[model samples]
Target: MKALYQYIKVIIQAFSSLLNGLLLTLKYFLTPGKSIITEQYPENRTTSIRIPERFAGELVLPHNENNEHKCTACTLCQLSCPNGSIEIFSKTIETEDGKKKKILDRWVYHLDMCTFCGQCVDACPSDAIQMKNNFELSAFDRNTLTRQLNRPDSRLEESNKQQKNTLAS
Candidate 1:
């Protein structure tokens, strides 16, 4: 009972000291036009917040000259994904040259399940795939997050044309 009385007294004294300090701080804070250390939540946005070109966020395949995705349907990326986020359905495609080549039949990716570890990017033999810096991935539906990226028939030729025009200019 005596120890309890002492503890209560100590606690009361500490609380009194804390209150005095807090009141002093609050006095300054209440002053008109006092500088605020924190900004309002999420009201500010600017172009400077963009990630650098080297900052990796998600992986995707580049396209070839024929407007086709460069993914050889190797399945290396699919196998390397830690969370099974990548699913590739591939089949043989015969070009005009009569050469059989692996092409993606279906490219299903669950971004919600992905950890973005970049293991799949490291495992790719072809310079076909790389991590892109698009991070605005919040979604309403989980099913819609199962995205289809780098369709087999991509507009690679248009990209090349744009590149050529940029180079020429």
Candidate 2:
């Protein structure tokens, strides 16, 4: 009789759980549009979605019309990066006064390995690097993921040039 009671109790609990699940399903089914959580991506890409200002997506170096940047090749951003995504290559150039100064040759950023922790941006003392709002970073080739942040013809700002000149003197 005890075994029969336990069996009956188990059957009742199973039926209770099933009824609870069915009630939840019915509640969602009867709701107007509240239960619909699927987002129509790509189709609604242009109109529906809005990217927030605080969203950190890709790293970019801003340059002015003069093709000047603030990066001094201090390597602080590269050092602070946990994933070693930033690689800076610098070249020493002899000034008119015969003073050798380090200049940024290439600022390689590996987007594939970047974790988007914003450490590089935070560590940049010159405020040369920053995260952009563009999140569409899909690529076909892995080599395409690696990009040079600095433009080929970009140079140091006039302020930095003056500072270097003063130091050299």
Candidate 3:
């Protein structure tokens, strides 16, 4: 009798689980307009479809109107990268006061090797880098995926220069 009771209990639990799943399916079927989970990418590509702000689509180093960036060549982002996707090359130059300081030369970003993990952005103390929502990253050639974040001849931002001057003094 105990064995039969145990078997019946198991069957009832299984049936309950099945019923719950079926109910969920029925609810979704009945409320198709409310249960939109997937976006029609091709059709909605040019539409006003909004990508969420938190989406880590592409890493970018933003520049100001003067073509200046805030990277101080601190190497914190490079050190924190788990996949070695970010390579920073800095050059030391003497400031007006003859103080030698390091500045960003080339910020090579290997998009092919990147896992879209925002660890590098979070590790940066200077807030030099951030992830942008422009996710059209498909490339025909692999070499095109490798990008340099800092533009040629770009220097540090004016505010950062002021901060450095204050710290130097």
Candidate 4:
């Protein structure tokens, strides 16, 4: 008799659970076009689609209007990359006062190998690199994904030098 009672209790519980699900479905069916969680991706691409600011999409080196960047060729970003996605090539040059200075020659970023962890951006002391919100990273050729972050003939910004000097003094 206890076994039969237990079986009946389980049936009642199952029926209650089923009724709850059905009620939820009926509520959703009645309230059409309200509180929609589905986002039509491709159709809304150019319109109402919103991407969060914290989304780690693409790594980029921002250049000023004068085509100058903030990278000091410190290699901190390269070292912070876990997958070796960032490769920086720097060269030593002599200043006007004959002081040997290290400058950035190239800043290569391999988008294919990157995990979008944003550690490289965080490690940069000069704030040279940052993650942009552009997520369309698909490419037909793999070589295209291997990008140079710095623009051609770009140099370090003069404002960066002034800020460093002020901070030092």
Using lDDT as the measure, the top candidate is 4
What stretches of model 4 exceed 4 Å from their correct place? 1-26, 162-169
Runs in model 3 lying further than 4 Å from the true structure:
1-19, 30-38, 46-48, 95-97, 165-169
Superposed Cα deviation of residue 129, candidate 2 (Å): 0.5
What is the per-residue lDDT of model 1 for residues 26-93, given as tens digits with 9 covering 90 to 100? 88788846765555534643533547888778667666556565555668889999899999887776
Which residue window of length 10 is worst by lDDT in model 2?
A: 160-169
Q: What's the TM-score of each model vs. the native?
A: 0.59, 0.79, 0.77, 0.79
- lDDT of all predictions, in order shown? 0.73, 0.90, 0.91, 0.92
Lowest summed lDDT across 10 adjacent residues in model 1 is found at 155-164
Model 4's lDDT to the true fold? Answer: 0.92
Candidate 4 lDDT, tens digit per residue, 47-140? 8688999999999999989999999888989998999999999999999999787889999999999999999989988898999999999999
Q: List the residue pairs that clash in candidate 4.
A: none
lDDT for 90 in candidate 3 is: 93
Q: What is the RMSD of candidate 1?
A: 8.8
The clash numbers for all candidates, in the given order, read: 0, 0, 0, 0
RMSD of 2: 5.5
lDDT of 3 by residue, 1-169 (tens): 9999999999999999999999988998888897576778888887747889999989999999889999888898999999999999999999799978888889999999999889999998779999999889999999999999999999998788777667557
